[model samples]
Target chain A: MEIKHEKIKTNLQKILPAKASGDKWDLHLYIAGQNPKAVTAFNNLKLICEEHLKGKYHIEVIDLLKNPQIAHDDHILAVPTLVRKLPLPERNIIGDLSNKERVLAGLGLVDHSELKLV
Target chain B: MKKKERPSHRNILPKSPTSIQGLDEITGGGLPKGRPTLICGGAGCGKTLFAMEFLVRGATLYNEPGVFISFEETEKELTANVASLGFDLDNLVEHKKIWLEHIHVERGEIEQSGEYDLEGLFIRIHLAIESVGAKRVVLDTIESLFAVLPNQLILRTELRRLFQWLKRKGVTTIVTAERGEGAFTRQGLEEYVSDCVILLDHRVNDQSSIRRLRIVKYRGSTHGTNEYPFLIDEDGFSVLPVTSLGLNYSSSHERISTGIPRLDTMLSGKGYFRSSTMLVSGTAGTGKTSIASQFAEAACKRGERVLFFTFEESPSQLMRNMLSIGIDLQPWVKKGLLQFHATRPTLYGLENHLTTSIKLINKFEPNIVIVDTINGFMVGENQTEVKTMLLRLVDFLKMKQLTAFFTSLTSETENLSIPDVDISSLIDTWLLVRDLEIGGERNRGLYVLKSRGMAHSNQIREFRLTNHGIELLDVYVGSEGVLTGSARLSQETKDDAEQLLRQQEIGTKQFGLERKRDAMEAQIVVLRSEFQAEEAEALKVITIEKARNERFTQDKIKMGKSRRGDVSIKTTGTKKKKYI
Candidate 1:
């Protein structure tokens, strides 16, 4: 998965252009602690948000280990789970954000090819 | 170290007892405490119930609150399902002693994009435990996560961690899993939760479905290895522990009646020992059931409770049939001294019958139990199963000190030395009633084939089913070899005729002896008369001679009278000449 994420970062950067809509993107990153996966997810998410929706996306990081009781609100099970709470319908995207293409589609920044596949 | 030296079982391990009947004994104390135990079974095999019962019993009975996390059933569904079993889940939940958490995970609801773990489930479980202060936890079918997550590697690793976490939490936990092919649990959950493993199965044998539970493995403890039949009823779940078949029951010296007075007399003037198992086997119409009913009647008459199990007949039908033989089973039933359980032998498997009977016995607490014709249970079952069932029942009854009477049917031509079901070895008293066919007559002959600890009658007594009750008469043993029925009647009549002929001969002999005595008396009189006549005649003849002599003497006397002195001298001279 890490190798795939590196391949996606190179390929998606060349194919994508910074195009932001007026609608604000609200994102919540759910993690148990600052593990390597969570750190990689945070870094990957920042890079994708800045490159795509630089000024339109708002990001909030919630550590489950400090407030473990709060994890049930979104039913977070994985470390580095990013939940889009502001997009009319809430969507949960679990796994490290290293897969930038799937993250872009999950955040609705890219064409929802994942939705079509499902 | 303390466990080895304590000489007591309580010192071994801390236990959380599930108050399910007979289960605590099988596990030696319930699931391992503060550890994860796996319960796996096929669908509808009662795994969920077993897990829920563990949680509920822990919370309600042990004063230890519990958390129930269901991955398949919601709180409402689980509550409703167990409500029928008399578990008030809603009430328990409201009391803060129980907490219900439903983890609703749908594959379509979440998309896998970033690397993630199962922190949400852990958090929710921890919250529920904290909320209830739980010492027990149940995760029913957590394998549902495997179906939804689509990530086996992560799920397996997390499952292992979850079990360790539960152990660290110090709460006795039950993780129910779906049974897999040739494996204890689907997804190999048994590998993670290995402290204790219980397998529940619902099997159909001979058209009867019996629910059984077995302790597949229990680490660091002793447990019964045999599969035990379990019952799920309105009262709750109960397991019929196989530990009862260990011959650990007590024996009594007290005697009970066989119901028939003469039959009692046949059995050493006493009947059966208290808590003894008795078998009355015979061919068709040989009054096997009659003897059983009579024993039940006797027990009821003594104001003792009796449970009569009839596999071949209905309760009312048995009562009426017994009534024909003058054994009224209705009054005792009405008085509650007798209870009748009528079921077909093929209605269920032997295990079901055994567990159901055990449940009934536990509830009724009867002093005597009568299984009319144990042959009913042997119809579709193997010999070993039948023996085990009967052995367990007898042990249970003996432990309770309750007399058990069973009747078995044998073929008319079958050997009478043993019973048909081959359970005679377990019986303390075996009464064999056979049809005595001799002289073209069939009579009922009842005798004790084998009676332990008593001097039972070795003679086969002729038993008749009279209108009053069963009557045992002394059978006639003659040259014809144990004459019975009309043969006995004819022999008795012949003896009476001989006696009458002997009396007539005695009367004739007396009359002849009396006539001989009269004739002898008359002859003696005649002889005495003859002798007397002869004597008189002799006397007459002598008198006549004397007269002639006297005339002559008179003349001489006259001459001597002239000379008185001469006469006196003559008398003196006569005397002297006589002496010479």
Candidate 2:
């Protein structure tokens, strides 16, 4: 939780210099319940979008407990899932998004680093 | 009412019947209810089919909606695969009786971060289960999760929790896994936590494949431990719990005739006991098939269904051959009283043969089953397998009160005292047909080697395959010991000739005696007449003498009257006595 707060603070500093990209970013965050991991994952995701995607990003928080049928659409099998549906090539990052670089690379935010996630 | 219907042993875990043909019996009732069952097998060993069938049976037969979460197969593929088994997954899903969810676990497309649980999967499965109110859940090949997720530690832990959650939901679950190196599954841990574990195997023995299942462990219940052969055909998945049957099948005292009256007479004037095992073992050309067909024809003629499993000959060939002996099977076939399942025994392994036979028996519901040439199932080094298969078949038939007839072909060199298949122990009646190589001729001879519970003819009869089926002529059992074929014919003719000659001699002796009696009567009659003539002449002469004596008496009386009247009468009486 403390790390997520620090990341958000850092992202706030970068927001002034960063300009929102032209492409709209639509992301869906799937979680089962209001657990700490989901909260941290949502916070970290919001911070990332604010810094990198700015106002052009759209985040949908979907609690699977509320509507579990949506899990099938995204094929989410793990909690704290982040699905980027905006781009033509969709990407999904599972878990709490604790590995910031891995998540960023997975979401195709930066140039792919050829880091083998497996 | 429901409380009264509950079992007396409340402690014994209640079971949800799978409704699979024979699996429930082997599992002692079914997998532990409300607990996960592990079905592990290698590729194409029917693990997926077993799990799918469980769900389908639960949904359709038990009124229990089910959820099938397949991690390995897509919904379309699974649907198409199960569709062949007559399970309409689409309809079931549409009706909300079953829920099919394909968990696409693409390892390349999935990225793992720290501190994640399988809450998403649980929620998806939970929602599907709730949507259908499923009482059955299947995680088909959940071991695939280990492949997609890099962190096996968390996946295993979450899976364990998932089982607990499923238990809490009180739904029967089936989790399929891949057969590992030596363990029951690739992820060997599933066998430990699952309430029951089934291992499926597809083995190719002697170039023929067979699928078998074994329950590695079933907690809180005693189950059959022997490996059971399972089949997946058009009718879907079925486990043959043949080994689970005991020898407690009820038997009948009612008898049935083998088509040949002589054979029936040999077998205690009745052919075979109903629900009994009849064995006909003989060498080649000894008419084993004929006896089997005869039994089948007789059963069919009695208006009972007959299943003729001809392993060596085609149905038409068998019918034609049987017709040569004047036993026409075509009428029975046309009348639908007899069904012929003719196939090469080599087409399947022993287990498949057993499964196929069982399927046919169950479907046809015959009163009699004839496995013509059971030796066809006797391949290289598989006698035990064939024996077990036949034992199971015989048990099944007996349980259904169907008489089972099996014909076995033995080599001439083998001992004829026992059945070739070493299954005489189970046979209720055993007929041994052997070639009588006597008098430089080979003739067929049949005798009842054994007939349980009734008196049977132990004497060997000259077994003839005449134009009118089988003819059992009494073997010549005189000083010649036992003669068959032309030897018996020749001996009988010779005996008749000897008897005729003796009758002719006796006739001549009787004629001579009659003539002698007639001639003697004529002589006696002539002699009596001559004696009568002689006696008449002699009486005439005596009469003359008496006249003379009377004259003399009269003169003497006259003289005596002068002397003394009393004395003269006495002298006259003395002279008459002298003349007499």
Candidate 3:
């Protein structure tokens, strides 16, 4: 019975790598409508994730004009807000994610010193 | 057919009266309903307090539930700060009458990454309003959003949208902002929220702080344009609408005694009119306070409430001083018929003093209000401001049909001239108390300079502060003008002596004339008797001489007749004897 239980636990761990590694970043970007700033923010965020987060992050685009009721869940004040969820403590970044280094540092994916040379 | 366009009076908007003292009168009714009213002021100028009071008063007095969204102060701090003003925000929240939301925005914690709208704030406010079914809303210092939010354009847009949303919600709103340099509000919030804009100012003039409120703009409404002074006491905000008080106070035909019999006699023998304002102006040591105390005592004696505001003396000191003169205000105070509010003139600005006294007048509902030494209010204010404030106060008192007595201290040489504040014209009755320094003695003299609609004595009365209150004596008007004090006493004594001396002289002259008349009568009686004796002697002599002559003449005639008439006499004698 113990051996069977251990085998099931290892299989479950292998099946859920996103949870086992604890390195997955779930980001939700809030926007009023399909504006240029939202588009730029989406493109910039996609680039940052590809460079740093790679496959360890999932991006959810939420248009506030369509789903404005959910904006308060993450305390979104300004449009195109970047909320990093699924981490122990949630953090928010306002404006379009133009500064890749500052965005990386804010998401806790990179240290300030690591981005100093870049 | 040409039709004249008549001015339509059908589109008048309803207002929400805040029930604040003197505020409704200036706003015509109150703030505009279902619209945003911006209350902007400098730091510590009572912006938050004003908004909170509006909401609280609206909720309590008008039965309108409210929502308070504070961006700077927390619910606990806000509640505690307004607790001193007797507003129980917690209890209101518990009863679901008010909803208080504290939105803390830390500048360090927020970062600008992308464009966003303030939907979160809107959602929170909506939820608060809906939860409490609020009809009134207050955003205390919404300028804090500018400190935390980096995008000004987005913030401005969201703010404009929020104001419109509030209007759509049909809730009267008060949005507080910080005052900017040379602008009504910081960030020029007045440009967008133009429905109603009120500016509050906290300024220190002559080391005393005064808070003033002025409606910069009120659309579709006529409001007082002058800056009104407002006071924040335990009760709440009381705005004194100085210029808004029209000269339409109702006049009363009733009369009230001035407590001094002689003074009352001087004032038409019926004292002042019931709602008349009396100004007792005097120099130093002219018994102004004494007169005010007497009036207060008289009001209390008549079972009317009296509020005595003394700026130069404390309550205990005044009581003790009045006690020495047998006024005995302690009984009236204990009976709750009399109240004394004593403070230093330097403690507050002139407007503050005015508002405070007005507040007390409203609370106590005094039939008579006596402000001892209105000159004390001139310590930290200009003469014009003082006079304006006094005019407003007198107007309010008269409107309420309350007898108001004001005492003023003039300069020694100024006499009846109210140098500190020229409120004589506003006064219905003006009694000028002066110090008559004559014959090396100082005495108080009181005379009515002007009394409207009543025949008052113009003669100066010597005012004496005896051990039993004030006594007004008729001053002696002799050759040296109106004589009072020792001069009057000496003049009266001299007049009495002169009168006595003249009476004595007249009495002696009458006595001498009577004695002379008696002697003349005696002389006439003696001369009459002597003349009678002489006439008797002459009569006796003439009778004896006439008898002798007649006898001689008779003898000669008888002898001649005997010779010629022997025969005729014999015949006549014989015939007479025969006829007999």
Candidate 4:
């Protein structure tokens, strides 16, 4: 069961788009400075959010250097913080965005089998 | 089109016989007859049982021959599965009352274009129905046709035509459909069963698997709308309806012993009435079986037959284990006062178990019946089936005026692992057992959850397994709370802590009150002393003023005396002249 579930998750990641269009939950990836790992993480998170959440998600790229005051107001203590400000139940995920399962759970749309771990 | 018969009018539709236990009551007798009723669910949701029970019950109980066409399971597997429920499918088959057929629809069976339509299925059904003169039929997973026929449009049209043809044939039918991920039926077969639709769902909630049945739609009949919980046991399927019975139910005013003397004393004088269903539920090893056995033994001793059903343990094992506590069931078994029927829960489908149980219940006519470890019976069955089975058992016991007792095992970790049969709502008496951990020890505890029409022990009693039988110890209401599994000798520690806290609160309040009273007392004393000094000073000042006035008067007299000698000589001449 575990191996099959993992394979489903991997397959899902392959066909997902980097950025979803016309999603209701618009999330901006805010980073202080851009590095190669940071760029890869942002692309990976975008791909996952697009595939699973599909039309219900939106990804935006934000450079904290240009808007330092906005980052401070939003309480962005970490460099890479994904902020969901549009939805009624506002939330934030702070990480390099590698763990797809955790991100899915944080978004409150994780599958029942996958949500158990979270 | 020609003048329709008033009795056969759609408005006066005949009731569909659910054949499963309490379902008939909820359905107001049963599903509509001569209509294609749909039963749909996901994999392992007990859709097959729902369909099979309807057909088998139609043949045996209702005296209506039936046909079963399975698209998934084989004839042997279906027979063997329901055998444990005491369905005796072999016997039913031998009697020619029921006809069973398994249809295979592999990927290779598909044909691009064919005029055959669903005629292949129609022929098989017709043959089976004609062979047994069946008035009812079941097609287990007609959706297998979808897998065999690639063209969805042709499949849909043929299915609609097939239902019309069956309706004309006037044989009541149940067509099973595989449920999709979130939808009610996998292929939305709900749209196809045009006349009636029922949904069967199986799920494991809180670690206990439950089966639920919902009447999606029942045309032209007064039916129950609630999602009734059901049980799939050896006998057959049972639907537990939450609705109330009619006002004309039997109400005999007689009480019987619960087999526990102390407990009986707490319940008014004796215990529940003769035919009352009693529920004994508790955490594992809370002595549920022991309590149930005691009830059985008591009835047997009174020369009444007792039927003991054990899903968790065998008859010999249960007898041997109970004997350790001095309950000799073997003597009664030999004398026909006691009968034991033990089997694994998976021995048959839920409906078969129910039917088998019904058969045993009828044949034995036991004064008392006990089902040990109801949780095991919940494995393949869903919640609806379990509830229905219990309801039927309770109703049957009440109808026969026989006492029935059941024990359910609750999960230790979860408060409600599975909706451990809510016998609480149906039974006349409910006994709750638990394992309490206090003072680092475990103790067995018993409490009455509820007892209808009788006063029961509300306090939790600590009990033990002694040489003779289970003994109810003194009510454990010491410094430490009631002990459940084992009692630790640390009551003094808890008592000391409670005493200290009580004393601290009392001391705080006493000190506050005494400080305020002492301040008031000191103020009163100071005011009294100051008033006394002022009074003495006022008296001294009055005395001094009086003395000064006397001295002043005396001085005035002396001054007048000194001046009077000179003035008297002058005034004497005037005074003498005035006197003359």
lDDT of 2: 0.83
Candidate 2 local lDDT, residue B162: 89
* Native contacts recovered, each model: 0.72, 0.84, 0.47, 0.00
The TM-score ranking, best first, is 2, 1, 3, 4
* Candidate 3 structure quality by residue, lDDT tens digits, B1-580: 2234344444565788878777888889999999999999999998888888888888888889999998888889999999999999999999988988887677766666556677667776877888889999999888888988887998999899999999999999999999998888778888778899988999877777778989888999888988988888888888888756687777999999999999889988999998888888888778888889998999889999999998899998989998888899999999999999999887777877877787788889999989888877777437678778778888888788888898887786655555434676788898988888788889988899899999999798999988999999999997788898888989999999999999999999999999999999999999999999999999999999989977875675588686886554444447558668
Q: What is the DockQ of each candidate?
A: 0.45, 0.59, 0.27, 0.00
Model 2 lDDT, residue B500, Cα: 100
Q: What are the TM-scores, per candidate, against the unseen true structure?
A: 0.81, 0.84, 0.79, 0.49
> What lDDT would each prediction earn against the true structure?
0.83, 0.83, 0.83, 0.72
Model 4 residue B578 distance off true place after TM-score fit, in angstroms:
99
Model 2 CA deviation exceeding 4 Å by range: A1-21, A112-118, B1-10, B417-421, B501-580
Off by over 4 Å in 1: A1-24, A33-39, A65-68, A111-118, B1-11, B416-421, B500-580
lDDT of 4 by residue, B519-539 (tens): 999999999999999999999
List of chain B TM-scores, one per candidate: 0.83, 0.84, 0.82, 0.56
CA error at residue B152 for candidate 1, angstroms: 2.4
- Quote the positional error of residue B389 for candidate 2 in Å: 0.7
Instruction: Please list the residue runs of candidate 4 whose C-alpha ends up more than 4 Å from where it truly belongs after superposition.
Output: A1-118, B1-12, B44-49, B60-63, B67-134, B206-208, B231-236, B242-249, B255-272, B277-298, B307-330, B339-364, B369-400, B404-580
lDDT by residue for model 2 (B1-580), tens: 7887675556777898998888988877888999888888899998888889999899989999999999988999999999999999999999999999999988777776666888989988988998999999999878888877767788878888888888999999998888889777778766345688888999887788888889888888888999988888888887877656777777788888888888778777877788888888888999988888777877887899999898998999888888999999999999999999988877877767877888899899988888887777776476667677777777777778888888888877885533354677788888889999988999998888888999988798888888888888899989988898788889999999999999999999999999999999999999999999999999999999989977976786678678875643555558678669
